[model samples]
Target: MTAIKAADSTDQAGVWITLRESSVPVRAILAGVLVNQLGGFLQIFLVLFLTERGFSAVQAGLALGCYGAGSFAGVLVGGAFSDRLGPRSAAFASMAGFAGLLIAVLYLRDFPLLLTAITLAGLVGRFYRPAAAALLSELTPQHRQVMIFAVYRLAINLGTTAAPLLGTLLISVSYELLFWVDAITALTYGVIALLTLPKQAKRPARPDAAGRRAGGYRAVLVDRRYVLFLLATFVQCCVYIQYVSTLPLAMKAAGLAMLWYSVAISLNGFIVITSELLVTKITQRLPIKLIVVVGFALLALGQLMYALPWGVGVFLVGTMIWTIAEIAAGPTMFSYPGRVAPDALRGRYIASQQTMFNLGAAVGPVVGVAVFRAVGAQLWLWCALATMLGLGLALLGMQEPDTALARRAAAATPVELTKDPA
Candidate 1:
């Protein structure tokens, strides 16, 4: 039995090792993503910075909300750019624009100018994802798409883990230094992209291939099943954001120390980094619909855990449960749009998905805090119900990924111009 278990573990380890040996462009993109996340301190610190500068809590909250709204807009604009200009140009522009806007934010103290700077910064900053996602899809084989996205999530988790500590140290030195350091990170990513990523000619106008449409955002909007998927995604995301927004407050209300809350967050990140890839590998062969359903079910279960009697053990258990849900759902969720989208409409599809995520993120804190305050601990039960609803919609509305429609769309995709440099 011991030898059997050991062999299983070894096989799992080998899966990760093979995943790490992806092509050069994929690796480069992952590295840039990691570096970008390491300096992603502005969103974390913006509220505190504004409050420290004598703004009221309400004012600071409004600004942060504006930033989220900007991110939503950015995703839409970025997706359009990715579809029209190609991923390389969109990425370069996002990073460079983000750096410049961050600098503008550093110097501006007045409320109006500062708001504009941060909003534009968010707009530019978010452009990277659709472009990056499109590029990765273009570069990777279909069978490997989920695993590659798992690596992308791992990079984000690892960088997020390191960011808070680094941001804390820099803020102690000076808040201005924090902005400058973040700007430098964006600039660095821009430079790396310019030097390493391949350039492609603009996508030439072509008639809609069989099984695909040629129109831009309009095509994405009109897909009835895809729109249903987006709605489910939005609700799940809203439930997910409660972890950062109201879960801590709920814990505090339940008499748990702030330390326990921090520990829960750390555990969440650690679990994602350690388990996401392995879980993705193990579950990659499952139907996408099944994986997503299981994920949402886990999310519902985790939220229900919060409604149990208050205890440190229960809190940690809840955190682990939802962390697993996040791991199970994330790669598959992000990769689905890429897989099913018409090749011509890939960027817009991805962007539309991201827009739903951002919208949920922006609205979550407000709704979470409001519900928690009004209903006290019972808020979690409602959250669980929401997840179950989302799960039901996903089961009903999501199409089978291997259906003829999907296969035809995949076949219709044009050959990518850039050759594998591996």
Candidate 2:
């Protein structure tokens, strides 16, 4: 057992060293994403802020729903922009726009105005993701995609782990300051994109392009497998979003303190940071479809864990379970669109997935809160069932990437081989 443990440690060290060899732009993008995420105050504080200002729970849910709606639209638009204007331009625009909108949010006191501001903020904030993903795909070779994305996820988790603690500190001083800090970080990311990212070279137009107009999103829509994958992703997202949308309110209703909820969230982030990279390394040889199916299963079980009658200890366990699901699923999920997409339509493919995921997020809060009010803690059981359905969908729909690639290569191979004439 001791020898086995030593071998495992050696393998982890090798993976760590491999990830450390990523290029300059990759490192810069990761740093920018980390800094930007650290200042993500909206998800953590937005609901609490609304409730403190005397808004009803339903109203806060609606506001977040609007944000999700805007996010859906933004990702679709951003994908097109990434293709047309290039990834760097798309990312810069998104981050800069997000910063401006966040500042606008700070001054808006009316519910309608605040709602509008938040929606716009979500729109601009979300645009960065598809653009960044597309950029990474462009820069990295196909074989390195999983490891690179794992590094990206690590950066995001690290930032997320710090965000709550930072929010806690900033909110104690003034909520307004939280808005300012968030905006500044976004602006900083924009600057990084502008200064460090190279301009994308223009793609020469295809000779038959004028005759063949049904490309990009139109082409992506016709891919039945990808569509099914999107359906599975939507369901998974809806189930996962409950933690942010309804869990806090549920805890409050159960007479639990806010401190406990914060601790649970922080714990979730910490688990991701500490374990994801190593776990990802170990799982790299596993079938991608199996990994995703298992992730969905874990998600279902985690949700059910919340339905148990125990206290914060049980909740923490649930958090850790879902965190493991996230670590298992996230890099594979991000890599799939890139793997399947044609070079010209990669942005649109990613955007389509993001749009579906965001739509689920938009709907999750409203549904979760309503169900929670109606069924109390039993809401979690229903969510678990929903996630189980998602798992089934994934198993049915997701193809192994290696199998697909092998088929493609086989189709392209010449029917006969001949020796060179001398």
Candidate 3:
């Protein structure tokens, strides 16, 4: 369970045991991911269900907004709780609540009731993400942080890929059946997490300096380096939303079918997983910021291709290009924040990032849809391109952390604090 072994984890030839590492940190990450992905399918279909039940687009947006707002609340609350009580307890509580809410969704059909249920579900489910993220950060050695988070992201996308398709098949039979399936998976994950996560996992102690900021959102904001990364991520999320929010309508206008659109999204997730694996192989040698900029450039190029008057073939090309970019950039983005976070406030730092991520996720759809509605398809791709370019330029302005900082931090950390139990 040493850092070296964690870093050198392997599976049988052609099989990556990304989840089966000896480290408890990796195990906990894998477990959390399983839970997140299993229940996450429920999120994708909420809007569709609302629309089917006679809610307007605006109402559906509002309901989702409420869900995001609820998640925001959970991030703050969970950040504090995870920082105080450790990620294991925080995750267990969050999963239990998520399962409870999913079960409640079955009995509630009215808009108000459903909205309330979704909000609660978001609240409960979101609490675990930051906690799990912080836990991974705590467990991983400096050199392997990016790979760890990359693997974590890969697990999430894998779960997302499987769950929605499963829900879709169930939906073909009955939405009620889909709900039941989601509930069962969620509950199962809750039980698994409770059983597998180490009982003794505890929050690390704060750095001693009474005057220094120790925990919470305020502490995270005070770190100018983290703030810069946060700003960069904000812009990235703003632009990334088009894939889900505006891309479908634009493709439809250009004669692509909804089936292809779904294919593109799945492809995007697949490419993201692949890119993360590639990035993990080279991250020690390459600068992560440079890698992320490369990703942004790819995304921008894809958007530009979409802006052109080409047909379905070009559309597929654009999606493939952006898919690679997503894979390259997404894992490093989260991994970097975890690396920079102080051990004591890791929960808060991770939560703040997720908070911003969710905030942008909520705002991106609203803005992308609003812009698409007002201007039409011609402007959509251009806007996405512009956003990507802006983020790339912004990335250039920030200072990149070198191996020295990571080494210094690792040297300073107490061995008893981070060692694996035999």
TM-score of each: 0.86, 0.78, 0.79
RMSD in order of candidates: 7.4, 5.9, 7.1
Score residue 219 of candidate 2 by CA lDDT. 77
Using TM-score, give the best candidate's number. Answer: 1
Q: Which residue runs of candidate 1 sit more than 4 Å off their true CA positions? A: 1-21, 48-62, 201-205, 208-214, 404-422
* Per-residue accuracy of model 2 over 277-370 as CA lDDT, tens digit each: 7787766545677788779888988998888878887788998899899988888887778776666677888899888887888788899999
Residues 1-422, candidate 3, lDDT per residue (tens digit)? 24334334632111154334437656756765865686576668877877777779898888877777787889878887787777877878887888788778767768788889989888887787877788787776555666667778778877876777777888899877877777777666666667766553444554467424534677777666677667767777777777888889888988878998888877777667666677556553356557767778887777777777777777788889877777677667777766766666778878877877877887887888887788776565656666665575547534434443575478666788677798
Candidate scoring better on TM-score of 1 and 2: 1
Off by over 4 Å in 2: 1-15, 42-68, 102-119, 164-181, 201-212, 245-263, 307-314, 372-381, 405-422
lDDT string, candidate 1, 297-377, tens digits = 899889989989868887899989999999998988988888777666788989998999988987888999999999987
Pairwise TM-score winner, candidates 2 and 3: 3
**Structure candidate 3, residue pairs in collision:** none
